[model samples]
Target: MSSAKYHQIKDHILTQIRSGQWQEFQRVPSENQLAQQFAVSRMTARRALSELTDAGILTRTQGLGSFVASFKSQSSLLEIRNIADEVRERNHSYSCAPVTLESIDAVAPIAIALGVEPGEQVYHSVLVHFENDAPLQVEERFVNPELAPNYLQQDFHTLTPHEYLSQVAPLTEARHTVEAITPNQQMCTWLNLYNEEPCLQVIRRTWSQRGIVSFARLVSPGSKYRLGGHLTFTKRS
Candidate 1:
């Protein structure tokens, strides 16, 4: 079958979801059904579904079927995760808008956090993340250029800062401080939160073999996101 056949199938499915013809948790047609309806091979239909599932438009259950994804988004408090991955795994589309990326002179606070001289230049970035076209989080970061020199040149729309840094400087130690606060207006605008809405913020600092790699402030609006973690205890031998 032509590549256009699979793309046509994907576009149909997306249109159905977007138009509310297929609601969240509603089961999408099986590959066999789609193949028959589209007059294409099952392989083509399967490709469409698999691509949609990988893109987080649909969630599939083994032995069951694929369903339109729901709105809830979640992440782990105890682990450092690529927010893009976190969004997709929850059956939600992930997108990012890069608001700022530049080399800026570090102020006293940024300098202290990065363990650099107060006037040293640091790579800074601000990004707003989206889940299913709705704003989810705002990530503001400062990178130590010595650790990741190309931080400023990265295309954040293609890959998140977390993903890029993990590649260049594998994490050795990470510190997280999570708190609830009322975000400033600019942050509220970034996350699409109302002025009075509360936010969950995590102040994260990561280290590599040499020294600190980055300092970041990750903030999510209270109503639209969640953070959790799980651990299994093992008896020591």
Candidate 2:
């Protein structure tokens, strides 16, 4: 099928934002104005606006229209399972849609995450995690070629990265860090985020018995995914 009108309009707005033409927290044009400018249906304009809102690029409220949001931050606490699994344990339905998967040479960031030399070979995958049909997270990940030779051969729609890795590589050690990520236009569109809603980005490196297994960067709606744990101090003699 041809590209959707909303997607085209969304891309245009994102281009403006990336070009610095649309400053942070600034109000975008009204839906009617955008529709007229784009020569699209009002519903099409609405779709574009909705897409931005889901991507955390813009915030929308009842009768308030839409406004841009600042860059988001990523946050993570000690957690062992996928954020989807965490939400599911609370009785909510969690699902994922695998978008793209391919083998590629590792870039600098991927190499760093996988603890490999830059330009090394790796397997890359992009998946969107959803909670009850609403886009919740975007997972961009790389796998060590030596560890997961057939990474792209498996069916990710039926098995999550955590699940697949657990079966093949069984985690032995891991390092996880969190930070804020101001997503690009594509990421925002995939996650259905708003510009105003910052996102939580979790960077995880995992090892198996042999060596580095996988490195994954997980991005999610900050409002939906939160980590909490209780701590206690022990007395020493």
Candidate 3:
């Protein structure tokens, strides 16, 4: 059968599963049966099934048939403006745990990122962002003490870092670089990511009118979170 026929049959099967026609843990139609129904070869039907199974949408058992896999994670790539607001907008619960909030001396790399002199004291915070009780992202940040004084006294659990920063210091400009990376031992334990699974890492630096206010390293499970940027072009005459 043609690839078009295979796609059609695959989509039909997916729709059935998604629409609750084939409930979870229920066996999907066999390859031969699906081929007969779609008037295609068994090879074409098998290919569709194999691809879907690889995608984590279907589970196939030897001597049995395919079943729908649960734990479907929804991911969206968006800027880190207000994670709590975004999650609530999507009707998903959002929460955070401030792991460490303290004042620390900036090292060479961190000083450069924060646009500060090396050995300068800065406010540091480690936070874990969550969606519906599942840990989603880990944020390790260093803030300019001049911009955010007495930062450690404030409670981040009640107010997110983004919210507090926006209230005190409106962001003037932001820079970001994203990459796929392997999780370290600490990250694996926090994000619950397997060793072989790739995680998305975003390095962001935000500047206020005063100067660079903060530099943050954001790490999220690739399977559960996605980062995205939006842009609009302007014409110059």
Whose TM-score is greatest here?
1
Candidate 1 TM-score, C-alpha based: 0.65
Root-mean-square deviation of Cα positions for candidate 1 versus the true structure, in angstroms:
20.6
Model 1: per-residue Cα lDDT over 10-54, one tens digit each: 878877866679998999999999999999998999989976664
Residue 143, candidate 3: Cα error in Å is: 0.3
TM-score of each: 0.65, 0.63, 0.64
- Residue 98 error, candidate 2, Å: 0.8
Q: What are the runs in model 3 whose C-alpha is more than 4 Å off? A: 1-78, 235-237
- Ten-residue region with minimum lDDT total, candidate 1: 69-78
| Candidate 3's TM-score | 0.64
For residues 1-237, write the lDDT of model 2, one tens digit per residue: 123766777767766766679886788888898888877888889977875664445667668777765542223346577665776887888788999898888654355456577678899899998888889888888899788787899887767888888888887776665666677788889988768478888766677888778867788778877756665669998
Off by over 4 Å in 2: 1-77, 230-235
Better of 1 and 3 by lDDT: 1
Candidate 2 vs candidate 3, lDDT winner: 3
Q: Rate the local accuracy (lDDT) of all candidates.
A: 0.82, 0.74, 0.76
Best by lDDT: 1
